[model samples]
Every structure is written in structure tokens, then in C-alpha cells.
Target chain A: MRTIRFLLQKEFRQIFRNRAILLLIGVMPVMQLLILPLAANYEVKNINLSVVDHDRSAYAQKLITKVTASGYFKLRGYSASFKEELRKIESDESDLILEIPQGFERNLIREDQQQLFIAVNAINGVKANLGGAYLTSIIRNFNEEIRIELLPPGRFNPAPVIEITASNWYNPLMEYRFYMVPGILAILVTMIGGFLSALNIVKEKEFGTIEQINVTPIKKHHFILGKLIPFWVLGNVVFSLGLLVAWLIYGIIPVGSLLVLYCFLSVYLLAILGFGLLISTFCDTQQQAMFIMFFFMMVFILMGGLFTSIDSMPDWAKLVSRFNPVSYLIEVMRMVILKGSGWKEIWPQFGIIALFAVFLNTYAIINYKKTS
Target chain B: MENLYAIELRNITKTYGREKQVAVDAVSFHVNKGELFGLIGPDGAGKTSIFRILTTLLLAEQGEAWVEGLEVKKDYREIRKIVGYMPGKFSLYPDLTVAENLDFFATVFDTTVAENYELIKEIYVQIEPFKTRRAGKLSGGMKQKLALCCALIHKPRVLFLDEPTTGVDPVSRKEFWEMLKKLKMQGISIIVSTPYMDEASLCDRIALIQHGRILSVDTPENMTGNYPGQLYAVKADQMYLLLKSLRKYPEVLDCYAFGAHAHVSFKNAFEAAPLKAYLRGEGLSEIEMKPIPASIEDYFIKLLKT
Candidate 1:
């Protein structure tokens, strides 16, 4: 414990002394919380749309009016030919295009069926799929209105009937802040473990003070544990500070136990620190450590189920996320803060994190050596 | 009085890598208690490797070492408590203030600065003006003093410094050795390693190491005294050509340039006046010839040649 205190003091002194590290730890969280949410949104708005009209009839005009009235698509431009419209789609100047066939009013009256063409960009597979679905729904509503208005006496039942209402939960308003803040919190908390610990050991290696520690009476585990405590405590402080800001700036209140969130956070922090210590043992330079940390940071954050729902991922991808500690922590944070979950509800996730903590820490301690 | 032997090694050998590059061969030497011992060698002579093994930071592949009567491997923890190690480079928390660094090291050994306050007071007082300054911000000499103070904070029975004055100015190097002398007076066993030949005289005994092997181990005075050949200092108007010309002489055993003069040894008994006359005949003018006492460097070169 004395060794731990010594190492803790050493690490804290280093972190506090480096202004750049301090800024990364304290100010970065708020900046990410504010900027990333506004920029990284799943619900795409302000979609630009182009229209090509061949019939130029009242029916085609009414169809365009209905598409514009729905407010899902903004008519940004009008094209004279299908060539021009297709060119617009190819160039990505517009997200979607609407086309009306010639004699559309005559066809609807004579054959009781008319075809409307819609083209959309599919690069962002999810957004494209959603846009296609929304466009179909708008056309379906217009067809139903035409049926009720044009054919009053005849009971043909031409307009196919099916109703589906989409609902969003947790963040029913679909605010990006609600989706992003918890995930960024998880990332920052884990970074505290990996980056700080790796840098600390690498700094010692550079300064040659590691030999001083090695020649001391302190056991290897004592030395490692001492280094872990200060960063662990600092991670928690940052976690709590993030929570405080969420409440004060955005009025986000936890629906679950803060203690459970902290417990999972602590376990995740240890696992990250253990992984970092393991990294430090293998790396000899601070530049190498930073590069390794950057690689792992990219993997963990991307796999944390932050941008896309883990449930929506394929089975293999979802299965892979189980190995990512950040994935478990994100779920635990959301469960505790959003669902107000208790120990019984989150015990399984907490167990995985505990195992990760124990496994990584054991691996780190076993692999770590006092000397090169 | 305490036992004369402060440290002992038996066939200590350490090999690095899976391929086993021998860093320290089957080498053995000991330093008496309170003796200022130096392991003098050039770079890559395995001086730091030896210290690492003795301090228990690294374990040798073969052989044994003991410090203060405790086996290095078996009693490593106890040895750690009784040894102070300052590596070849400045190895302190650069971000921490000088005082914070001192306090941290002292705390690691379960000791307080106040307890060893008297021991480190001399070194620490010099760096006290920069107590609040970060260690990285201090000058090289200041950093050197701070490292020494931290090393002595635990007041260990033995001090292991690995080329502690390598890059410092010459005056600071002189001052550092003077500080080591004061600590020696206080009964600390010191083992310092250096490549500086001038520092050999500062130690009671030194082992000249090369290529993971010991060339010689004796008192500086004794090592210089045992030069096998009669060496003469020779210089002429063209010293380079003079050295080259002397090397071609059948009577000359070894002729190597040292500073402004050439240290020439003869194959058999020869006189200095004849060598001067011989040089004059070989287009040399204003020759200076004299026999002088051998220095440690001369002995080192002779040892290398033999």
C-alpha cells in the first residue's frame, strides 16, 4: 500500500504537471459532448430533393404538393429531363429524386393504377433505406386520398391498406445529446486508464527512473497497484463531473442508480489500466505507446455501440462486441442512467467487466517485469 | 570493524535475447566495505548490466552475487532495502518538483525525509532553491544533485551509480566525485562505473572491462606500476611522421601516439639519446625525448595490446 501511495503520488504529479494532459482529461469531455452530438446525428434532416415532371398535369402537381407537404423532403431543384435528374443523383447533388410519368391523370382514371418513380442514394445504407421507406409512405397516403376523393360510389377498394407507426424509445425526441453523452463518457473513462498509465510507465523508461523503482523493496504487484489507484480515482472524478455537466447543461437525469454506474465504471477502468500496463510492458518508447493507445482507442470507441445500435448489428459483429469492455460499459451506463436499473438487472454486465478486470490485471502483473 | 567484503560475485554470467548474446561473461569481483570501487570500461563493456544484476533489477543466467552478506537472488527484497541505485541517465519524475521527487522516493522505502533529513541535507540544500521547480526544468548539474539526494534519501548501506556524470560538464563531474567522497566518509559502500580514464585514480580499486570481460583488477597505483616494458615519451618537429618512422624501427616494440607525444617502448634495452639521434637522422629536427612514468591509460593500451 505504501508503494501504491508512492506511485500514485508520482503519477498524479506527472498528470497535473503536464498541462496538455490535463486539458485532454478535463476539457475534452465537454467539447466532445457539445460538438459531437450536434454533428453526429442518426436522424438525417434537411434532405435535398429534385423533381422531374413529364405530365405537367394537376394530378402530377398534386402529387408534388403532397410530397412537399409531408415535410420529409425539401424540393431543392426542378429538372426538365430524366437525364438531368439522373445526373443529379449520380453527382450526389440531391439525396432523392421524384419522377412523374406522362399521362399520369389519364392512367389513374383509365387503369386505376399509376407508377411513380423514386431514386435515392444508398451509400449510407441505413439512411438510404429509411429515406426510401419514408418516400413510399408519402405516396401511399396520396393514393389513399385520391381513392376517397375520386371514387365515392364505387366500392373498388383499390388503395391497399396497411398501417405501421414507428416509435422511438429512451430518447423519444431523438435528440443526439441523449445518444452521444453517455458513450463519450464511457470512452473518456476508459482513456484515462489506457493512455495515462501507458504514458506514465513510458515516461519512467525514458527518464531511467524505472531502475530506481525496480531496486526498491516494493513488490511488482505493489508497484502496479499503486500506479493503478490514482488513475482509477481520477477516472471516477471525471465520470462524476461528466454526469454533473449532463445534468446542469442538458438536464439529463439518471433513471437508475448512480452507484451501479460508478461500480461498472470502476471495473471497466481497472480492465483498461490492466491493458495499459500490459502495453507499457511491451513498449519501450512514449511514441510507440501513444501509437498503440491510439489504435486501441479507435477500436474500442468504434465498437462501443455508440453510433449504431449493437442489437441491429449482425450476429458475428454483435458477438465481437462482447469482448469490447467499452461495449459493456456503454450498456451499463445507459441501463443505470436511462433505465434506472439495479444490481439484479445489471449484474451480468458487471460480471463480464469484473472478469475482464481480473483477467487483464492478472495478465499485466504476470507479464510485467521489474527490469528490461 | 565490519566485514571487509561488502560485495562478492561468483561466476556471474548474463545472456540477453533467446539467442543468448553474452552481456556479462563469467566475471567475478568484490569491493570491500566503504571502498570507492569503479568498474571502468568503454561503452558496451557491460558495466550497467553488472550493476543491474547486483541490484536485483536483472537476474543472471549463471553464477551468484551477494551484497552485505545477502545473496542477490535469494535475498533480493532485503538487498533492495539496503541499496541505492542511480542509473546511467537522469531517471527521476521530470514533471514533479525536486522536493516532490525526493519525498516520493523516500516514501517508497517506508522512510521519511525528516528521518534521513541529516543524511541528504548536504545535497538537498544545494537543490533547495529549486525545491518547487520541476525536475525537468532544472539544469544538468542541478538535476545531478537532485538524483543523488533521492538516491541517498533511504540511506542505504550501498550506493550503485552507473556513469552518473557522463554528460555533465567537467567541473560538475569533479564536484560530483567530491560529493561521492563525502558520502564515502559517512560509511556508504560505493560502486560507480565510468568510461572516463581520468576517473580511475579517484577509486581505491577498479576493474578495466572490455567486451564483457575483465582486463585487469587492481589499485590504480599498482596497475600503473606493473607496466611490462620501458616506455619513453618521443616527440619531433613532425610528430605523426616521427611516430610512423619509429614504428618501422626493428628495436621498437610498440609505438603509439599519446597526446602531443608518442609513447615508445623498445624490444630490448635501449637509451633515449640514441633514439633522439636516430630520429634526427631520419629527417626529424628539434626532437624531444624523455622517459616518463606510465599512466593508467598507457597500461590500458598495453593490456589491450598484450
Candidate 2:
């Protein structure tokens, strides 16, 4: 314990002594949190639509008005020819084209049926899908209105309409930042903790100081704990700072117990730091450690359900996320910060992360041998 | 019997990587209690490899080593407790201040600097004024002094220094040897390695190593005293022509350039007068020739060739 105290003291002195690293630790997360959520907005809007009206009918004008009025799309151009409007799609001036067939109103009244065509640019698949879904729903609503106007008053309809009124639980306002802030806090802590500790031991290797430490009588675990504790403490400081940023910028406070939140963070920091140390032991230089950490951070964050929901992933990808410690933190952050979840709600995830901490730390210590 | 040998290695060999390059080959040597021993060789001669094996930072593939009577492979933990190793590289945390570096190392071995202050006081006092300065900001000599102080902070029974004077200035190197002598007087057996042959003379005994093998292990005086040749230092105005003529001389056994002079080792029948006369006859002016005792460098070169 005394040895750990001294090691902690030394580590802190080195950390504070490096001015560039100090600024990086202080500035990086705040910048990322403030900028990424605002730009990474998932709600798609302002899709450009072009219309080719061969009929020039009143109903065709009404349809265009209704599509523009829905607030999901902007009518970019109108042309008499289909090819001209297709040219609009090719030039990147518009994302979709709607064509009204000739005699469309005569066909709807005489034959009680009509055909409309929508050509969607599928380059940005999410935007294209949402735009197509919105246009289809609008047309369905228009068809229902025309059917109601044509129905005889005495002739009763037998079919029932099922409607769904979605009430977004936990985040009633559905503010993307409210959902993103907690997850972003998870990423913030993971990155600062992982990158710092990942570079720590490998820096010693590059400087050749580990050779000095390895020759000493210090126990292997004691030395690893010495490396672990300082980062764990720093991880907490960064976590608290992130929490303060979240509360100040987004007006978000955890609905769960603060003690429970801290409890999870403490264990999560250990797991992540252990992972960093594990990466360091496998690498011989800071450059190698940085690249390897970057690769893993990429994998962890992308699959961590931070940007994409894990539930929607294929079986293999979902299996991969099961091993990602970052996912659990993102999940626990949402559960605690947004859902008002207590200890009972997060116990399973808590147990899994605790296991991760133990497994990773023990493996790291065992892999770090003083003697070749 | 075990107490007499501070460190011992026998038939130790190490091979590196898939290239199968030999680092230390079947090498054997020992350091006596309180003796200042040096492994004298040029770079890539496996001096650092030997030190690493003895320090337990590396494993010897074929031989056994012991430090303070504890086996290296089996009792490494015990060996680590009893020995102090300073690698060729400056291994202290550069961002850390001098005092912090020393104190951190002191704490690592579970002993405070106060407990071993008397042992390092002689060297530490020289660097004391800069205790608050970061280690990387220190001069090369000062960095070496601080490294030595940190290595000695734990007061181990044996010390392994790998080229402690390689880049240090001459005056600092002399002071460093003086410090080693004082530590030897305090009964700490030292095993120091150096590529500089001049530094070999200060060690109580040295093992001249080359190509992962030990060539000779003896006192510096005896190693030079036992040099087998009639040695002569020959200098002339036309040094290159003189060198060409000396190599072709009948009795000239081996000759090589040594600084500004051609150091030639001749057979027993060879004489200084004949070489001097031969140089003059070859149109070389202002020729100088004299027999001088072989230094460790001369012996090291001879050993490397033969």
C-alpha cells in the first residue's frame, strides 16, 4: 500500500508536469461533447423533390401542395417532361421525382384507380428510406380523403382503422441531445481513460524506464496496481467533469441515485483501464499503442450502440458487441440518466462489467512478467 | 563458499528472434565480493546481454547464473532484491524531477532514500542542488550522476552498470570511477560494462569480450604485462608510405594504424633501429621509433585478431 502511494504520487507528478497532455485531457472531451451531438442529428429533413406533371390537373397541383406542406420535403423543380425532372435527380439538385400520369383524374373517376410513380435516389440510404416512407403515408392519407368524399352516407364501412399514438418514454421531448449526452459521457470517459493508460506503460517502455522497474523487487501486481490506480482516479475526475458539462449544457441530471451512478462509473473505469494496460503490454512503442487503441476504440464506439442501435444489428455483430465494455457503459448511462433506473435495474450489467474488470486486470498483471 | 562469489554465470547463451543471432554465447565469468569488475568490449560484443542476464531482465538459454548465492532462474525474486542494475539507456523518468526519480526508485525497492542516504551521499551530493530540476533538462554528465544515484538508492549487495561512462565527459568519468572506488570500499561488489577500453584500467579486474565470447579475464596490468610481442610505436613524416613499408618488412608480424602512429608488433628478432633505418631508406623523413608497453587497448585489439 505504501508502495502504491508513492507510485501514485510519481504518476501524478509526471502527468501534471506534461503541459501538452494536460491541455489535451482538459480540452478534448468538452469540444467533442459540445460539437458531435449537435452535428450528428439523426432526424432527416429537407429532402429535395421534383415533380413531372403530364396531366396539369387540379388534383396534381393539390398533391404537390400537400407533399410540400408536410414539412419533410422541399419542391425543388417542376418540369413538363419526365426526362427533365430525371435530369434534376442526376445533377444532385433533387433527391426524389414524382410523376403524374396523363388522364390521372379521368382514370380515378372512371376506373376508380390511378397509378403514381416515385423515383428515389438511394445514395444516402437513410434519407431515401425516410423520404419514401413519408411520401407513401401522405398519398395513403390523400386516398382516404377522396374515398370519404365519394362514399354514400347510408352505406356504412365495416373496416376498422388502427391508430398508434407513440409516447416516447424516459425522453418525452425526444431531444436527441438528451439521449446522446449520456452516451457521449460514456464515450468521453472511455476515451480519456483508455488512451491515457494505454500510453502510460508503453511510454515507460519507449523511455526504457520499465527496464529499471522490472529489475527491482517490486511485485508485478503492485506495479500494475500502481499504474491502474492513478488512471482510475483521473478517470473519475474526467467523468465528473463530463457530468458537469452534461448538466450545464444539456440540463441533464441522472434520475437514478448519484451513488449508484458513481458506483457503476468506478467499476467501469477499472475495466477500461485494465483494457488499456492490456493493450500496452502487447505493444512496445507509444505509436503502436496509439494505433492499436485507435483500432479498438473505433470498433467499440461504432458497435457500442452509441450511434447505431445494437438491437438492429445482425447476430454476429450483436455477438461482437457483447464483448465490448463500452456498450454496457452506454446502456447503463442511459438507464440511469434518462430512465430513472435504480440498482435493481442495472445489477446484471453491473455484474458483467465487474467481471470484465477482474478478468482484464488479472490477465494484464499476469501477462506483464518482469523476467523474459 | 557461496558468500565469496557476488555474481556467477556459467555457459550462458542467448539467441534473439527468428534470425537466430547469438547475443551471448556460452559465456562464463564471476565477480568476487567487494571487487569492481568490468566487462570490456566494443558495442555488439554482448556486454549488455551479459549484464541483462545477470540482472534477471533476460533469460540465458543454456547456462546458470547466481547473484549473492541465489540462483537467477529459480530465485529471480530474491536476486532482484539483492542486485541493482543500470541499463545502457538512461531509464529514469525524464519529465520527473531529480528528487522524485530517486525517491520513486527508492520506494519501489521498499526502502526510503533516508535509509540508504549514507551510501549514495557521495554521488548524490554532487547533483543535490538540481534536485528540483527535471531529469531530461540536465546535462549528459549530470543525467549519468543522477542515474547512478538512483541505482544506488536501494543499497543492493551487487551493482550492474552497463556502460556508465560511454557518453560522459572525461572529468566526470574520472569522478565516476572515484565514486565507484568509494563504493567498493563500502563492500558493494560492482559489475560494470564499458565499450571504452581506457575505462577498463580503473576496474579491479576486467574480462575482454568479443563476438559474444570472453577473450581474457585478468587484472589490467597482467593482461598488458602478458602481451606476447616486441611492440613498437613507429611515426614518420610519410605515415602512409611508412605503413606500407612496415607491413612488407620480413620480421613485422602484425601492424595496424593507431591514431597518428603505426603501432607494429614485431617478432623477437625485430629491432627498433632496423625499422627506423628501413623507414629512412624508404625516403621517409623525421622518423620516430620506440618500444612501449602494451595498454589494454593494444591487448584488446590483439585479442580480437588472434
Candidate 3:
């Protein structure tokens, strides 16, 4: 225990001494939480659109008015020809283009056939698909209105249509902030625990002091435990600060007991820190340790379910996500915050986190060599 | 009866990897209690490997070793308790303050600065003003002093220093040796490794190692005395041309550029005066030639020859 205390004290002293590292570990999360949600939203709004109405008829104008009124698409420019409007969109001046064919009203009323064209840039395929779907739905709804107007005035007709109700369970609006803030907090905590501790051990190796420690009477368990404690505490502190920002800015709060959340976070932090120590054992230089860690973090954050739902991913990707501790923590955080879940609802996630903590720490201890 | 030896290595050999490259060969030597022992060799000569093995940071295969009467393999845990090791590189945590580094290392051995205050007081007092200073921010000399302090905090029975004076300025190197001498008086057996041949004189005895093998172990005075051959330093106005022309003589055995003079050895039957005349005939002026005492480098070169 004394050895653990000494190692922890040494780690804290070292962390406090490096100003750049302290800023990275402490202030980075808060800044990310405050500014990132504003830019990360997925809901497409106010999409600038261009129109080329070869037929300047009343019917064509009505379609334009309907699209503009829906708020998803705004008419930013009107071109005389299809080529001119295509040029605008190609130059990134507009996101979508609408073309109304010539004699469209004559065809629709006399011949009973009408056609229009909608073109959307597919560079960001998701946004383009959503925009295309939304425009098509508006056009279909307008056509149905005309059909309703044409129905017999005296005859009473009633037909049954199935309704989905389309209710979103925990987050009614699926607001991006509610999903992102908690996950981002999880990433920040994991980084503080893993990256910081890995750098600490590598720094000692570079400085030659680790060699000195090897020739001492200090026990190995004490040394390893000591190195982990400071980062573990610091990880929790950052986690809470992030929680505070989530509450104040996004009104996100846990319905579950604070104790349970901290307990799980602590175990998860231990697993991350142990993984860092294992990485440290394999690296002889700080730059090497940092590079390897950056690679692992990339994998974790991408597979961590921060941006995409794990359930929606392919089977192989979902299986990979099961091994990701950050994914579980994010799930638990969302459950507690949005679902107000307790131990029974989140126990599976907690068990996996505990297993990760024990497994990674044991791996670190076993791999660490007393001699080089 | 105990042999009064501070360290004893019996056929110590260390092999690394599957193919087994011998870093330290079947080498054996001992340091008398309170004596300053030097391991002299160039890079890749396995000096650092030997020191690391003695310090308990590595295990040497194929032999037995003892430090302060404890076997290295069986008693490494106890060996760690009684040794102060300063590795070849400056390994102290650069982020921690000087005081913090000292305290951290002292705490590791379950000892306090006050407990061994007398042991490190002289060295610590020099850098005491910089106690709050971060170790990385200090000068090379100050860093070495702090490293020494951390190593000595536990008041170990022996000190293992691997090239501690390398890359240090000449003046600091002298000061460091002086500090080592003072510690030696307090009966701390010190084993230091260096490639500097000049430092051999500072040790009570030195083992000249090459290619992981011990060439010779003796006092510096006797090693120089044992150098076989007559050596002469010769200089001319045009020294470069003179060296080229002089080596052409069949009587010359070896001619190497020593500072300000070329140390030339002769064939067994060669005469110095005739050689001097031969050089004078070659139109070299301001010629000065004289026999001089052999240096450690000369001794080592002779050993290599044999």
C-alpha cells in the first residue's frame, strides 16, 4: 500500500509539473463539451436550393412555394436554364436544384401527366439522401391534396390508414446534443486515464529514473498501483466536470444514483489505465508510446458508438464494439440520463466493465518485466 | 574467513536472445572493500551490461555472482536494497523538482533523507538551493549531482555507475571523481565504467575489457609499466610530411598520431640516432625527437598487439 501511495504521488507530481499535459488532460474536455455540440448536429436545416423553371407557370410556382415554406429547403437562387443552375450547385453555391419542365401545367391539366426533376449533391451521402427524401415527400403530399380536391363533393368516403405514431422513446426529438455530450465525456475520461499514464511511464524511462527505481527495495505491485492512482482520481474529476457542463448546457442529468455512475466510471478508468500501462511496457520511448496510443484511441472512438448507434452497425462491427469499454460507458450514461435506469437495467454493462478492469490490469502486471 | 571483497563474480556470462549473443563473457573480477574499481572499454565492449547485472536490473546467465556476500540470482531482492546505481543515461524524472526526485527515490527504499542526511549532506548542500527547481531545467553538472543524491539516498553498500562522466565537461568530470573519492573514504565500494583511458589512473584497479572479454586487470601504474617496447615522440616542422616519410622506413614498427607528437615504435635492432639522421637528410628542419614514458593508450595498443 505504501508503494502504491508513493507511485501515485510520483505520478501526480509529474503530471502537475508538465503544463502542456495538464492542459490537455484537464481543460480539453470542458472546451470540447461546450463548443462541439453546436457544430455536430445531424438534423439538416435551411438547405440552400436553386431553381430553373423553364415553364414559368402558376403550378410550377406553387411547387416552389411549398418547398420553400417547409423550412428544410430555401430558394437561394433562380436560374434561367438547367445548365446555369447546375453550374451554381457544381460550384458549391447551392445544395440542391429543382427543374420544372416546359409546358408542365398544360401537360398536367390537359394530358393529365406531369414531371419535375430534383438533383442533390451526394458528396456527404447521408445529408444528400435525407434532402432528396424530404423533397420527394413534400411533392407527394401536394399531389395528394390535388387528388382530395378532385374527389366527389356529395359522396361520403372513409378509408382506414395505418398510423405508426412515430414516437421516439427516451429522447423524443433525437436531439444530437443529448446523444453526443455524454459520449464525448466518456472519450475525454478514457484519454485522461490512458494517455496520461502511458506518457508518465515513458517519461520516466526517457529520463533514466526508472532504472534507478528498479534497483530499489520497492515491490512491483506497489509500484504499478502507485502509478495508476493519480490518473484514476484525475479521470473521475474530469468525468464529473463534464457531467456538470452537460447538465448546465444541455440539461442532461443522471436519473440513477451518482454513486453507481462513479463506481462504474472508476472501474472503466482502471481498465483504460491498465491498458496504458501495458502499452508503456512495450514502448521504450515517449514518441513511440504516444503513436501507438493514438492508433488505439482512433479505433476506440470510432467503434465506441459516439457518432453511430452500435445496434445499427453490421454484425462484425457490432461484435468489435462489444469489446470496447467506452461503448459500454456511453450506453450506461445514456440509460441513466435519458431512461433513468438503475442496477438492474445496466448490470450487464457494469459487469463487462469490471471484467475489462480486471483483465487489462492483470495483463499489464504480467507483461511488465522487472529486468531489461 | 571472509575475503574482504566488496563484489565477486565467478564465471559470470550473460546471453541475450535465441541465438545467444554473449554481452558479458565468462568474466570474473572482484572489488576490494572501499576500493574504486574501473571497468575500462570502448562502446560495445559490454561494460554497461556487466554493471547492469551487478545492479540487479538484469540477470546474467551461466555463472554465480555476489555483492556484499549475497548471491546475485538468489538474493536480487536483497541486493537491490544495498546498491546505488546511476545508469549511463540521465534517467531521473525530468518533470519533478530536484527535491521531489530525491524524495521519491528515498521513499521507494523506505528511507528518509533525515535518516541518511550525513551520507548525502555534502553533495546535497551544493544543490540545496535548487531543490525546488525541476530536474530537467538544471545544468548537466547539477543533474549529475541530483542523480548522485537520489542514488545515495538509501546509503547502499555499493555504487554501480555506468559511464557517469561521459558527455560531461572536463572540469565537472574532475569534480565528480573527487566526490567519488570522498565517498570511497566512507567505505562505499564503487564500480564505475568509462571509455576514457585517462581515467584509469583515478581508480585503485581497472579491468581493460574488449569484445566482452577481460584483457587484463591490474593497477594503472603496473599496467603502464608492463607496456613492452621502446616508444619515442618525434616532431618536425612539416609534421604531416615527416610522419609520411618516417613510416616509409622499414625499421619503424608502429607510428600513431599522439597530441603534438607522433609516437613511433621501432624494430628490435633499430637505432634512434640513425633514424633521426635519416629524417634530417630528408630536408626536415626544426626536428625534435626524444624517448618518453608510455601512456595508457600505448599500453592498451600493445595489449591489442599481443
Candidate 4:
């Protein structure tokens, strides 16, 4: 315990003395939290649309007006021919183009049906797909209106239909920011905890101080704890700062108990810090340690289900994500903050994190060699 | 089961890399309690390797070592408590002030600065004026003093200092040796290594090592006293040419350039007149010659030749 106190004192002094790193730790995460959620939105809006109306009939004009008025697209311009509309798409001026054949109103009254063509730019697959779906729904609504007008109101009655009213739970309006803020907060904590402690011992090795420390009477467990606790504390400090930013900038206060969130954070930080120390023990230089940490953080963040739902991933990816510690924290954060889950609801996740804390830390302690 | 020595090593060998480069060969030596022993060698002479083994910072692949009557491999925990090590480089926390480094090391050994003040007082007082300065900002000499102070704060039974005075100035080097003398009086056994040949005389005994092997081990007096032949110092107007001429002489057993003069040893004792005649015949002028006592450096060169 006494040895750990001295080691902690030295570590804290070194950390605070480096003003540039202190600023990076304090400001970078908050900035990322405030700006990233706004940019990482999945809601596609304001799609650019173009029309090549060859018909010039009342029904075609009405359809064009209805598509523009649906609020899912912006009209680039009206082209006289399909070739001109293709030119608009090639020039990057439009994302979707609609064409209506000539005699559309006569054909709709005489044969009771007509077909329209939609040429969607498939370069950005998601945008094109969603845009096409929105335009189809609008056209369907217009067709239903036409049918109702031609039926003379009460003369013919349609078959019975069931109305489906859908509601989004947890995020009533489906605000992407609410779902993203908690996940981003988890990433921030992981970055601070993992990178800093990962470089701790390797920095000592570079400076030649590890030789002095290794020759001392300090126990391996004592040294490991000394390294783990400081970064663990700093990780929590970053977590709290992120939470404050979430509340102040996005108005996202956790709906669950604050105690429960903190409880999970404390254990999660330990597992991550231990993993960092484990890397430090294996690497001989600071550069090696930094690169290795970068590799793992990249894997953990992309597969951790922060931006995408894990359920939508392939079977193999889902199985791989089960091993990522960040995945568990993201799940816990979203569950507690978005769903307002209780201890009983999150106990299983808590158990896995607690196991990681024990296993990773023990591995680090056992692998840390006093004599080589 | 008698433990008369503070440290002992038996046939210690260590190799590194896939090619198995031999760093320290099958070497063995011992230091008695409170004795000042020196390992004198140049940079790659394996002095650091031996110190690391005894200090429990490295493992020897083929041998055994004991510190303070405890095996270095098995009793490391107990050994660490009683031994202090100062590596060749200044390894203290550079961002930390001198006082903080000292306090930290002292606390790590479960003692306070005040408790062992007397042991490090003579050395600490010199750097105490700049106690608040970061260790990295101190001069080379002051850094050495601060490192010594940190090592001595625990009052260990044995202290290992590896090349403690290699880069220090002359005055600081003198002061460091004086401080080591004081620590010796306190009954603390000290083992120090240095590449500086002059520092070997300050030790009670030294092991002259080269190429990872012990060439000779003895007191400074005995090592120099055992020179096999008479030595002569010869200098002339053209020193480089004089050295070549001396090496070409049929009677000269060995010849090496030492500073301003060429130290020449002969197969047998001969008068300086014939040597001077030979040099003058080679167009040398203003030649001066004398017989000087062999120093540790002379003995080292002589051992290397064999």
C-alpha cells in the first residue's frame, strides 16, 4: 500500500506536469461528444430530385406537385427529355429522376392504369433506396385519392382494412442523438482509460526508470494496482465530464439510477485499464505500445455496436462482438440511460464486466516480470 | 553454509538473440561485506550485465548468484529489500524535482528521508540547494549525486553502482569517490563499475574485464606490481614516426602510444643509449626517455596482449 501511494504520486505528477496531454484529455472528448452525435445521424433528409415530364397533362402535373410537396425531396429542375434528366444526374445535380409518359390522363381514364418510370442514382445505395421508397409511398397515396374521387364517395365501398399504429419506445421521436450520446460517452471513457495506461510502463522503459523500479522491493500486484488505479480514476473523470456535456448540450440526462451507471463504469474502467497494462507489459517501446493500442481500439469501436445495432450484423460479427468489452459497456450505457433499466435488468452485463476485470487484471499481474 | 560474502556468483553465463551472442561468459567472483570492489572495463565489457544479475533485474541462463546471503533467483523478495542499485544511466523521474525523486524512492523502501538523513547527508547537501529543480535540468555531475542519494536513502546492506562516474567531470568524480569512501565506513558493501581506468585505484580490489571475460582480479598495487618486464617512456620530435620505429625494433616486445610518449617494453632490460641511437638514425631529434612505474592502464594493456 505504501509503495502504491508513492507510485501513484509519481504518476499523477508526471501526468499533470505534461500540460499538452492534460489539455488533450480534458478538451478532446468533450468536443467529440458535442459534435460527433450531430454528424453521425442516420436519418437521410433533403434528397435532390429531378423530373422529365413528357406528358404535360393535368394528371402528370398533379403527380409532380404531390412528389415535391411530400417534403422528402428538393426539385433540381424540370427537363424536357429523359436525356436531359440523365445529364442532370451525371452532373451530380440530382439523386433521383421521375418520368411520366405522354397521354397519361387519357390512358388513366380509358384503360384505368398507366406505368411511370423512376431512374434512381444508385451510387449512394442507402440514399437512393430510401428516396425511391418515399416517392413510391407518395404515388400510392395519390392513386388512392384518384380512386376515391372516381368512385362518387358512397356509391361503392372498399373492403375492410386494418390500421397499424406504430410507436418507437425509449426514444419516442427516434432522436438519433439520444441513442448516440450514451454510446459516444462509452467510447470516450475507453479511449482515456486504455491509451493512457497502455503507454504508462512503456514510457518508463523508454526513460530507463523501469530498471530502477524493477530492482525495488515493490510487489508485482502493488505495481499493477498503482498503474491501474490512477487511469481508472481518470477514466471516471472523463466519464463524468462526458455525462455533463450530454446533459448541457443534448439535454440527455440518464433515465436510470445514477448509482447504477457509476457502478458499471467503475468496474468497466478496471477491465480496460488492466487490458492497457497488459499491453504495456508485453511491448518494449512506447511506439509499439501506441500502435498496438490503436489497432485494438479500432476493432473495439467498429464492432462494439456503437453506431450500428448488433442485431443487424452477420452471425460471425455478432459472435466476435461478444468478446469486445466496449460492446458490453455500450449495451449497458444504452440500456440504463435510454431504457431506464434497473440492477436486476443489467445484472448479467455487470457479471461479464466483473469477470473481465478479474481475468484481465490477473493476467496483467502474472505477466509483469520483475526479472527478465 | 557460511555467508561471509555480501555477493557471490558462480559460472554465470548469459546470451542474447537468435544467433546467441555471448554477453557475459562463464564468470564468477565474490565481494566481502563492507568492501569496495570495482569492475573495470570499457562500455561492452559486461559490467552492467553482472550488476543486473546480482541486483535481481535479470536472470542468468547458466549460473547462480546470491546477494546478502539470499539466492538472487529464489530469494529475490528478501534480497530486494537489502540491496540498492544505481544503473549506468540517470534513471530517476526527470519531470520530478530532485527532492521529489528522493522522497519517492525513500518512501518506496518504506522509509522517510529524515530516517536515513545521516547516510546520504554528505552527498545530498551538495544538491540540496537545487532540490526544487527538475532532475533533467540538473548538470551531469549533479544528476549523478542525486541518483546516489536516492540509492543510499534506504541504507541497504549492499549497494550496486554501474558506471556511476563515467560522464561526470573530474571534480565531481573525485567527490563521488570520497562519498563512496564515507559509505564504506558505515559498513555498507559497495560494488561499482567504471570504464575510467584511473578510478580502479580507488577500489580495494578490482576485476579487469574485457570482451566479457575476467582478465585479472587483484588490488591496485598488486596488479601493477606484477608487471613482468621493465617499462620505458620515449618521446621524440615526430611522435607517430617514433612509435612506428619503436615497434619495428627487434628487441621491443610491445609498443603502444600513451598520450605524448610511446611506452615501450623490451624482452630484457637495456640501456636507453642504444634506443636513442636507433631513433636518431631514423632522423628523430630532441628525444627524451625515462623509466616510469606501471599504472593500472599499463597492467590492463599488458593483460590484453596476452
On TM-score, the leading prediction is 2
Give candidate 4 misplaced runs (Cα > 4 Å): A56-58, A81-93, A99-110, A120-125, A149-151, A154-163
Give me the displacement of residue A49 in model 2, in angstroms: 1.9
Clashing pairs in 2: none
Which portions of model 3 show Cα errors greater than 4 Å? A106-113, A153-158, B1-4, B14-22
Task: State the local distance difference test value for candidate 4.
Answer: 0.91
Q: What is candidate 2's lDDT per residue for B138-187, written digit by digit as tens?
A: 99999999999888888899999999998888999999899999999989
Error of 3 at A262 (Å): 1.2
- Backbone clash numbers for all candidates listed: 3, 0, 6, 0
Off by over 4 Å in 2: A149-158, B272-277, B280-283
Worst 10 residues of 2 chain B by lDDT: B267-276
With candidate 1 superimposed using the best TM-score fit, by how many Å does residue B225's alpha carbon deviate from the native? Answer: 0.7
Place model 3 in a CAPRI quality band. Answer: medium
Better of 2 and 4 by TM-score: 2
Q: What ranking of all candidate models by TM-score puts the best one first?
A: 2, 4, 1, 3
Scoring model 2 with DockQ, what do you get? 0.87
Q: Once model 2 is optimally superposed onto the true structure by TM-score, how far is the C-alpha of residue A185 displaced, in angstroms? A: 1.7
lDDT at B5 for candidate 1? Answer: 76
| lDDT at position B41, candidate 4 | 93
Residue by residue across A167-189, what tens digits does model 4's lDDT show? 99999999999999999989989
Q: What lDDT does the true structure give each of the candidates?
A: 0.85, 0.90, 0.86, 0.91
Per residue, candidate 2 scores C-alpha lDDT tens digits across A223-279 of 899899988988888788888888888889888888999999999999999999999
